[model samples]
Target: MNLLHAYVSGRVQGVYFRGWTRGHAQRLGLHGWVRNLRDGRVEVLASGPDNALRELQELLYEGPALSRVDGVEIVAMADEEQPTHGFSIAPTV
Candidate 1:
């Protein structure tokens, strides 16, 4: 399993980024949540197979059609922190 914690910046909020993330993650069979940050960024935490995580990382760079993703900062998390459920769109933090 692979765990990815990412902070996506630039034109990510107010554009259904969280929804898009949830759908994509779920389709990839990843487990975790995506939410908006108070600092005009989007935060995502996902866990799944290595290939799935990598594919998601690539998609994060593009984001939704209405978004202008500038960058994505990703960190590998410990397996112990991985979630054991479906993907979701969390409340803004």
Candidate 2:
């Protein structure tokens, strides 16, 4: 299993980015959440098989057609409590 923390920048807010993320994550069978941060970036944390996680990261770059994803910053989240079911859209933080 792998855990990943990602921050997607550039016009991520008000674009249904969180919903878009959840759809892809769930499709990949990842258990995690995506939410809008106060700073305008979309935050994503997910845990699943390594391959699925990698695929998610790539899909994030494409996002929804209405979005303009400028960058995706990835970080390794170790020893964190990850979700155990389907992906979800979390409240903004």
Candidate 3:
């Protein structure tokens, strides 16, 4: 399994980014949560098989058809951990 944390930046918020992310993650059988950051980026933490995790990152680039993702910063989470039961759109922190 692979765990990843990504920050997707651009015109991402208020454009169904979180919703699309959750839906896509669910479809890809990934587990984690996505939320909007106060700084206008969308942050996501996902854990799954390596392929699934990599696919999720690709989806973040063209989020929601409404989003304009300028860039994404991805980091591998060294500590392997199982995520929650399902993907979700977490409340902004």
- Best candidate, TM-score-wise? 1
Q: What are the lDDT scores of the predictions, listed in order?
A: 0.93, 0.90, 0.88
Q: For candidate 1, what is the lDDT? A: 0.93
At residue 87, candidate 2 shows an lDDT of 87
lDDT of 1 by residue, 1-93 (tens): 879999999999999999999999999999999999999999999999999999999999999999999999987667799887999888888
Candidate 1's displacement at residue 68, Å, is 0.3
Q: For residues 14-65, what per-residue lDDT tens digits would candidate 2 score against the true structure?
A: 8888988898888888998999999999999999999999999999899898
* Pairs in clash, predicted candidate 2: none
True lDDT of residue 59, candidate 3: 86
Q: Flag regions of model 2 displaced more than 4 Å.
A: none
lDDT of 2 at 28: 88
Which is better, 2 or 3, measured by lDDT? Answer: 2
**Residue pairs in clash, model 3:** none
Q: List the residue pairs that clash in candidate 1.
A: none
Q: Which candidate is the best by lDDT?
A: 1
Instruction: Sort the predicted structures by lDDT, highest score first.
Output: 1, 2, 3
Off by over 4 Å in 1: none
Worst 10 residues of 1 by lDDT: 75-84
Query: How many clashing pairs per prediction, in order?
Result: 0, 0, 0
